[model samples]
Target: MVKVATTPLDRTRVARAALKLLNETGLEGLSLRAIAKELDVKAPALYWHFKDKQALLDEMATEMLRRMNEELAADEQPDTEWPDALSAALRGLRRHLLMYRDGAKVYSGTRFTDMSYAAPMEAHLRMLTGGGFTPGAAARAWLTGYSYTIGYVIEEQSMGPDPVKEEGGYDLAARAERLAAYPLAAAAGDEMFRDYDAGFEKGLAAVVAGIGATMRDAPGA
Candidate 1:
């Protein structure tokens, strides 16, 4: 077989290529070899940059956050309330995670490869602290919001890239039939599967409110 010309490869370049391939092949089909092929290099060429697949995933997740941070920065406004800012940040995260096939699965539980996440995290924590939360409370509050966003995106992606546009994929009628023995669960299928956008907003608002009410009066607040 003839060799494909190799490109100069770096961690960022490889990770970005992997992210692009991810949309085509998805997380399950993604491999070092696949990324190498996408980058026009041998599989071993990737090891010079990433120690293993997990390391590559870490870089990809970090890149995803970097992009999300850019979007958040672009939309930021002066003197926004903490809850509003936090909500906006989480919404941005959800949108970012939904951009690729299995985007949330790729992002969830992966360690970041660099300090790119630190500055935005510091800003988020500062926002919470300024809103009368103790440092610990600030951390917890952020974790809660982040967890909700990640979990929600994962569920949304499980349905499809765009749940609202692909609503037929969910088979709500079948779901309702499956839950027919329990009348309330059958009825609840529409609320749970029909409109994710509205559901996410309502859920996010609840999470933000819960965090504020619980953390606002912590010891240092």
Candidate 2:
């Protein structure tokens, strides 16, 4: 093995190196050994920055979310409506995760390194609450939208290969033949996987609309 001088690693450097490995080998192949190799350090050196692989993964998730928020902020319009801003934020998150192999796998269910995420959280809460949602409804609305985006992307990435390729969609026609006896099930074949982007947008609109509708007549509005 080539022995390169170690540049003194920190949490940011370690998380970045792990993400590089994740893009190349994905989560299944990701390990402290691989990250150490990428960083040109002994595997044990990583333990200084992270207790274990899961800690490193949580940092990666946190970093990914940070970048997502930054990207969204760059393009945010001052006059954008709350619902539009909220939906766009979710879309930005999904786009950011699709950049890596098993990217959503790295994010979902993983913890963040700190509560500095309060900036984005506060922004989202302000949007919902300002739109007439009660405090509880605002929190739930933000959670529901963000959760839907992340959950959908997790499955989207877990599919056979990258969704950016031609192999992204399901063969509803093939499924229809398999479920010939079940009419509704067969009918759903087309709608279920025809267009994920369109589906996500439609679902996000529904969630935002529901939140807006329910909260409109409640205490806030």
Candidate 3:
């Protein structure tokens, strides 16, 4: 019989198996052998598509981005207008990251030097520019908001609560009691620990409004 070519390994399948493993085992437990086992293949099979563990993780991150793209694609009105459309996109992106076990870590570290991520930024820039922001102002606005959102989500997800036991949960009231001298900080202590959605919205709105105000105040703007 003539030699035949077996089906080539698909990176997407490998990535999906890896992400599933991540959800079950956490990031520290991720490994090529684990993913291969998940796929019912040998570890070297993964190497055909990914050079090593890091490469596999990077592809998994890209898969996470693809998930964000799907959400953004589903939004019925992504290009409706300035802040409206851009906010929808950003919210979709953030929500997708929050869905995974360690979504923020995957997004921040992935060398997504790929067009999928870049195209979104370009679309956002167009939205900002259409909203009367100069090129420099638009760029700065996107960067500031992006940075703040990513940083906030990373911290939030990293410190996500464990439901198995409540013994180690954050003690906002106890801390407030200790910081009596710092009136303002103490007063807002409980507020800071409110639901993540509320906090994320508050911060995002503040940043967007501040950026708009600054752009309007600029000379000739």
Which candidate achieves the best lDDT against the true structure? 1
Q: Candidate 3 residues 1-221, lDDT tens each? A: 99987555799888888888776776777889988898889988788999977787788888887777766766646548566665666677678777766667766756762567777678777777777888888889888877887888777766545322322445777778899899889878666765778888888888777877876334334
**Candidate 1: where are CA atoms >4 Å away?**
1-7, 161-168, 218-220
lDDT per residue as tens, model 2, 11-103: 989898888778778799999988889888999988988898889889999988777777887887656777787888788888998888888
Per-prediction RMSD in angstroms? Answer: 3.3, 3.1, 4.0
Tens-digit lDDT track for model 1 on 1-221? Answer: 99887656788899899999988877889999999898878898789888888898999999998898888888886588888989988988888888887889999999998898999899999988988898898999999999999998788778643433443357778888898899998998778766788999999999999998877765336
Worst 10 residues of 3 by lDDT: 160-169
Task: Rank by lDDT, highest first.
Answer: 1, 2, 3
Task: Please say which candidate is ahead in lDDT: 2 or 3.
Answer: 2
TM-score of every model versus the real structure: 0.90, 0.86, 0.80
Q: Over 4 Å off in model 3, which ranges?
A: 1-8, 76-79, 162-188, 216-221
Give me the displacement of residue 218 in model 3, in angstroms: 8.4
Q: Per the 3 Å backbone cut-off, how many clashing residue pairs does candidate 1 have?
A: 0
